[model samples]
Target chain A: MKIILKNICKSYNGRKVIDNLSYEFTPDKPVVIEGGSGIGKTTLLRIIMGLEKPDSGEVVFEGVSHEAVRFAPVFQNTRLIDKLDAPANVRLAAREISGDAVRAALIALIPKEELGKKVRDLSGGTQRRVEIVRAVLAPSDVIIMDEPLTGLDEGNARRAVAYIKENMEGRILITSSHSDLFEAFCETLLLK
Target chain B: MQTLSLSAALCRVTTSITWADSLKNGTARKILIIVFWLLLWQGASALVHNSILLAGPYESLLALCSLAVTSKFWLSILFTFLKITLGFVLGLITGILCACLSYRFKLFREFITPPISVIKSIPVASFVIIVIIWAGASSLATVISALVVFPMIYHNMLSGLEATGSSLIEMGRLFRFRFIDKARYIYFPQVLSHLHSAVLISSGMAFKSGIAAEVIGRPLQSIGNGLYLSKISLATADLFAWTFCAVILAYLFEKAVSLILKRLSAA
Candidate 1:
């Protein structure tokens, strides 16, 4: 899909956080948005995810723009409700995914031992993976992940990176702290 | 001078403390306390030397026993119990309705404040008299009880509603939860403990005010009416018995409500 994020200016209080910036993210391959903290990398991700509306400018996905495109976001923090268990937390968006499908998806990403435990009980790495699986399993046109590799040790991060590479269909846009990951797997779009 | 021995001190004491002696078996301790109080009453009645002034514990117990055998006693208890319970239920409904309506409309809350303040500050006896004059003796007690209870219920329910978390509500909105689903998941869970406390408090108030109404209104076949007659006839034993019965009924209602709350919390 062709995606364009044009003149995306955002500000908090009186200061400019995202200045008049323009970029395009499309799929012949995966794209990474790499930038420093307080450099509007997260703000840019939020604008693309439609979680925030810009002070000025537009985000267009497949030429339809923010008002048109169907979107899903895997947030930086694993925002699982404390009350629901691991499988139930993931199933909130994709209820149609059967027990076996949930089981299989969870088993593929999360260790089998942590499958039955609640998201709150699971370690940070496992919760991160569950959130990624939840995003992957959800039915969405564009999957946007903000800081998706956070908290995972290198081995699990690699496993998750591989899973996303294999399973993504339409488009993958990720915001990250490092560009080396972008170099190895996808084209890098540096935001300074 | 040498200090008195334990037995001499015990013998010289004017009063006994039974509650401290109450070990794990609370019921037995209560019985012991009752017996102690009964002996005290017996001793006091003997010292006074006037049956008109004070009836001993046995006299009250005998009165209660005799009253138990009579149909009027049962009828009085049942009628008073039903009227008070009904008043409680009505007050609960009114409180919840007022709370919800007040929350829904700011103007209504402002309008209600003056009257609630007036009711809360004024004496129950004043309300009882006013209601008796307006509604007559028979219906007055129930009305008084309900009025006495409304503020307690309404304020608690309002606080409960206010305590509902904004974040959880936002989550519910994002999830597109229906009104029923929102209430079940978000509204009820937050407000339940509050409502539970309100119910317990209001239930006790209902009994007290209901009986007080009966006393003032003189409703036939009610515990309050029995109390009134006993006072008129100088039957101190009967008065004590009926008052004991009222206390027991109130205790039982509180216990029953507490049990229900426990079950609800468990669920």
Candidate 2:
């Protein structure tokens, strides 16, 4: 499947965040958007995910209707339910995945004891990892992550990257981060 | 100070402190507080020296016992309980549905504002009189109770829905969550938190307004009628007894609702 953005323009409070941007996303190559903070890396990802409407542009998808394309996203805020445990939060989107499967997937990045604790109680790095597991386990044609490695230590960040690569299953992956941690695995898209 | 070994003195002080802490936090402390209030009430009743003016706790308990043995008293309790509960459940359901619709559609929310404002502004007594004229005395309590509950639940649920984090909703959208999944994960907890307080407050208000409606309408076999009869006959003890029963019923219902909501939240 191919996703293309043509001359997308978005402004907030009379200031342009994304201006005259165009890119084509292919399933074969994962793309990592890199830019300075508040450089509209998130706005670009949100626009592609249909979370925000572009001021002037159209997104064209080939081999998939926009309505039919499902997405799994790791929001910048790790939007896991604060009151739910790790596996339970993962099951929110991945309902078809069994509880055992969720637990097994989470156990790879999360400690066994910590898996039962609510996401709010876990450390920031653990919560980010939980978001990654949730995104990977959810049934989707595309994965959009906004700074997926925000709170991770270097060691856990590597593990998360490795985990995402192993489980992405040839789906189009688009992520935004200020750092180049994903440089080796993903094609870089610099947002000026 | 008496000379003593450090260990012995420390042990004694620790024991005293533990005892004080238990007294402050344990069920025994609650019982003691209640007993203190009961004694104060009894003292005030004695000072009045007239049962008609002020019924003591003993007189109220005695009146309650005498009423309990009679079939009419039980029937009145059942009648009022069923009517108020039905009204409350009706209000609860409609309030939740309306709140959901209002949250989904801004036009509906605006359209509903006037009626909700009227309900909140108008006195319960006025509503009771109007409802009696419209629907007659037979269903007055039910109608009044429902009106009392609806706006409260509606406003609280609406606020809860509004307070839900937008980011979580966006996440749900990206995940392509089904409607049921969105309700379960994204909305349920937020609404439930607000619902807990709303139900508690509204249920109590429903009982109070419902009984007041019955008193005003003089329904044939309701707690309100019983209360009215007790007042006119100058049987202060019976009035106190009926009021006691109403308070207990309201408390029990609130407890049951709170328990159910708590369980739902846990799930």
Which predicted model would earn the best lDDT?
2
Tens digit per residue, CA lDDT, model 1, B146-232? 887789988988888889876555435433445765666566666777888778888888898889878887988999999999999
Candidate 1 interface RMSD to the true structure: 3.8
Winner by TM-score: 2
List model 2 lDDT by residue over A47-113, tens digit each: 8988889999988888999999988999888688888899988988899999999999998988899
DockQ, per model, reads 0.17, 0.72
For the second chain, the TM-scores of the candidates in order are 0.85, 0.89
What would the TM-scores of all predictions be? 0.71, 0.89
Q: Which stretches of candidate 2 lie above 4 Å from their native place?
A: B1-48
* lDDT, residue A146, candidate 1: 72
Query: Where does model 1 exceed 4 Å of error?
Result: A1-84, A87-152, A155-192, B1-38, B49-54, B101-119, B133-142
lDDT of 2 by residue, B1-267 (tens): 455687789999998888788789986688899999999989999999999999999999999999999999999999999999999998999999999999999999999999999999999999988988888998987898899999999999999999999988888888877899799889998899988888999999999999999999998889999999999999999999999999999999999998898899889
lDDT of 1 by residue, A101-177 (tens): 98888898887888878677988878888878877777655667778888888878888888887777765555454
